[model samples]
Target: MGEGIPMTNSTDVRQADAAHGREMDPRLFREVMGGFASGIVVVAGMVADEPVGLTCQSFTSLSMDPPLIAFCPALSSVTWRRIRPTGAFCVNVLAAEQRDVSGLFGQRRDDKFEQVPWRRGVSGAPLLDGAAAHIECEIAEIHPGGDHEIVVGRVVALTGDAERMPLLYHRGRYGVLAP
Candidate 1:
């Protein structure tokens, strides 16, 4: 006779599977990752004397003692793929006033830097003219992640204007920091 309350060995296995797979639903990964507060960064590099860049939220500080930082670029990102081959990059922390700049970089347009203003950093990577901060680094290591590459960089120079508030990403929208 079937249990009145739906109890069974298969139910027990399903419950156990649910317990083990308690991580956020893979289908909602984008939404879940967006729920995490992250600073906006423009990752830039120069190749063949031309500068290229893209807006990314996957940047993070890795180590303070060794002065290391890292950012992940999706395998499908053409701009990042070019930068990877260049072997150097600059992470530009977007300023609250530079939302347009962020939009330009985040786009799939070919001429992303056409209308945007930028200047060369010490690393020769394009630095947005009014970023809140800029980290110039050399590619120290590249490791394969699921669908992205974890690019570790050795800090060469870290500079910023503290007067500016950072641009932020949350819940699938770009935002400004609260006062």
Candidate 2:
């Protein structure tokens, strides 16, 4: 969260701007965005000693030298606001069998991590026990996109077990990497 950001109604101006209407139909936009295959990831952080996570497929690496990455969390996503203030978060790249794990984190229900197990990472965020890969990050910047925020993070730690294939997202469903 940034200073003086009117959290009360983040969508006020965007709705007014929408009087001009969408440049692309939302159905088309969904199809296009879905066409771009992405690895599934669970983004988690502790907010007031409680762990919260959300499944995200909109993550991308922004820079390598400075070790930065970004993920788009929809402004309407309640999970995002709850976790963003924690200052640090962990990105757990899922393995092929983790679609259920993704769904668990993606839901609005409470205590998503109750059945899953995790441990603290160097950044003090939860490192999901069996992710194919994990990256710990500190919030670097926040840029508001039309309906989402581009959260930029500076990588502070990384760990992985390279043998596992990443969980994949395509065409509105989860898939496994082809061998």
Candidate 3:
């Protein structure tokens, strides 16, 4: 576990900012945010009949009444643009033992799915073979966020294994929850 951040008043924050001669450091902001553990997922889709995906840690369930979920993709992600036009995607919740798959999808490579075995979902998105869970969704809304886009998806299909542990990311490394 990571250490908790000390509570700071607005005045103290302002003083620290003044001392640093900057509003907030991007590196510090990322490091602080990384302290929070997040489940690792691969947001994948078929673009022109080719499998496209990217490792993402910014995934979460937004609503249950309407079956909504969301994930953030970086502004500069090429894979995101490819998947965006597909109108649907699959959120593949990676299993804890699939860190290598996550690392492969995270990179810019011609064949990310060369070794990844997957099948098409009902939404036409690639459903990874060993994912802890799979959420097929149609693109519902997209909102512009700083340095990333908040992509909301309306769940159309879902499947999972309760016994499978999910892969996690925290403080710039991968981890798995204890049973």
Among all candidates shown, the one with the greatest TM-score: 3
The runs of at least 3 residues in candidate 1 whose Cα sits more than 4 Å from the true structure, single-residue gaps closed, are 1-24
Best by lDDT: 3
CA lDDT scores, all candidates in order? 0.87, 0.87, 0.93
Candidates' TM-scores? 0.85, 0.86, 0.90
Q: Candidate 2 residues 17-127, lDDT tens each? A: 556774444654575567778998999998888888899999999998999999999999998898888899999999998888998988898878888989988988888
**Which pairs clash in model 1?**
none
Clashes of each: 0, 0, 0
User: Using lDDT as the measure, what is the rank order of every candidate, best first?
Assistant: 3, 2, 1
- TM-score preference between candidates 2 and 3, better one: 3
Quote the positional error of residue 172 for candidate 3 in Å: 0.9
Q: Residue 5 CA error for candidate 2 (Å)? A: 40
